[model samples]
Target: NSLAQFVFGFTESGRFGAARQTKNSLVINMSWGVGLGMVLDDKIFRGHNGFAGEFSHISLFANGRLCACGKQGCLETEASGWALTRMVKEKILEGSSSILVEKMNGKGEIQMEDVIKAANNDDVLAIELIAKIGDNIGRGIALLINIFNPELVILGGSLAQTGEYIRLPIKSAINKYSLSLVNNDTQLKLSQLGKRAGIIGACLLVRKRLLSLS
Candidate 1:
C-alpha cells in the first residue's frame, strides 16, 4: 500500500509539475518488470497523464477479476511481483504433490525463489506451475503488444532470472497476438542490466537531477 501510494503521489506531482515540453523529449523507463520501454517522437505514449507506460495495472481480462488496484482481471493481478508470489503461494497450498512441497517441508510457505529452484530441478509440479505462470505472463505481454505496438520490450526482475523458462512463453504470446511485421520490428529482449535495472534507473534519476543543478 505504501509503495502504491508513493507511486501515485510521485506521478501526480510529476504530471502537475511538468513544463509541458513539446519538443523531442525522451523518457526511457524500466518498470513493471514487463520490461523497459522508451518514448520518443511525439506523444507521451503513456496514455492520458503518467498512466501511459503503466504496465503494473491494466485489465488482463474483462471478467470479474480482482486486482491490488481493486479492479477486476487487471494485468497486475496475474503478472506483477505480487501476482507471482500469490501464484506460488496458491500452488504450494494446493498440495499438488511437487518437490516444491518437500522444499517447504509441508509448511506450504514458498516464495518465487523456491519455485525457481524447484523448477530448475525439473520438479513435476514446479515445471507445470512455472509453465502456467509463463503462459499467464505471456498472455499479459500479448495484451501490451496489442495495445502499444512498442519498438522493444525488455524482461527484467527477480523473476526474469528464470531465463528462457519465462521469455519463451512471452515470445510465444507475441507470435500469436501480433502481426509478423509489427512483432518482427518489436524485439523482445532480456534485460542486459540484470537485477540491477531498477536500482540503476533510480540512481540515474538522481544523477541527472544533480547534473542539472550544475
Candidate 2:
C-alpha cells in the first residue's frame, strides 16, 4: 500500500503545485514501518521478486533493538512510528515528563498521533524524540542519496504530517552525512498527496496496466 503511494509521488504535479516531473525520484513512507518506492526513467524499479523497497529492515543502528523481521538494529527501530511509541515509553520510564502522559491517562499506550499532538502543543520531550527519529531517518536517506542521486525524495506516511518538526532534522542529517555534490542534487519535500496518495496511486497503477494491455 505504501509503495503504491510512493510510486504515485512521481505524478504529484497537480497536487503539489508543480507540473508532472521527474523520471527519477524516490519516496519514503514512514508509518509503523518504512516503505520506499523509486521511479527510474519513468518506470517503477522493482527488484527481483518485486520487493525492492523493504527499507525498514535496513540495519542502520547498533541499538540492540530487535525488529519484527528478526533483525537487530533495523532503521525502523529508530525512525518509524513504532519507534516513536517505544521512545515515549522509555522517556516516561526515565522520569521525563510530557503532555503525552496526561493524554494517555494511565491507559499505558502511546500512539504516534498522540505524540505528534503533544509536540504540536509544545511538548518538549515529544519534539525531542521526533527530532531524534528524523536525524536517524536522514542518515539512512543520506546513504540512498549517495547511491541513487535522485532528483527528489518525498517524505510520506503519517509521520510526514509532523511538517517542519520532522523535515528540518532529516534535512540537517542529509546535509551532514551525504557528500555535498550528491546532496545538492536532491530535494526533499513532504508528500502533498497526503493520505489519499496510496489509494490514488493504486488506481493510477491499475489504469496504467490496463492501458498497457490495450
Count of steric clashes across candidates, in order: 4, 0
Worst 10 residues of 1 by lDDT: 19-28
In order, the Cα lDDT scores of the candidates are 0.55, 0.80
lDDT of 2 by residue, 177-198 (tens): 9999998968888888767776
* Pairs clashing within candidate 2: none
Best by lDDT: 2
Q: Model 2, residue 136: displacement in angstroms?
A: 0.6
Q: What's the residue-level lDDT of 127 in candidate 2?
A: 91
Poorly placed runs, candidate 2 (over 4 Å)? 1-19
Best by TM-score: 2
Question: lDDT tens string, model 1, 1-214?
Answer: 3333233333222221231232222222222333323333533233444444555555766757676667788666666555665666676677667776565676666677776777777777766655666676667666666666666555656666667777787788778866776567666666555555555555554565689999
Per-model TM values vs. the true structure: 0.72, 0.90
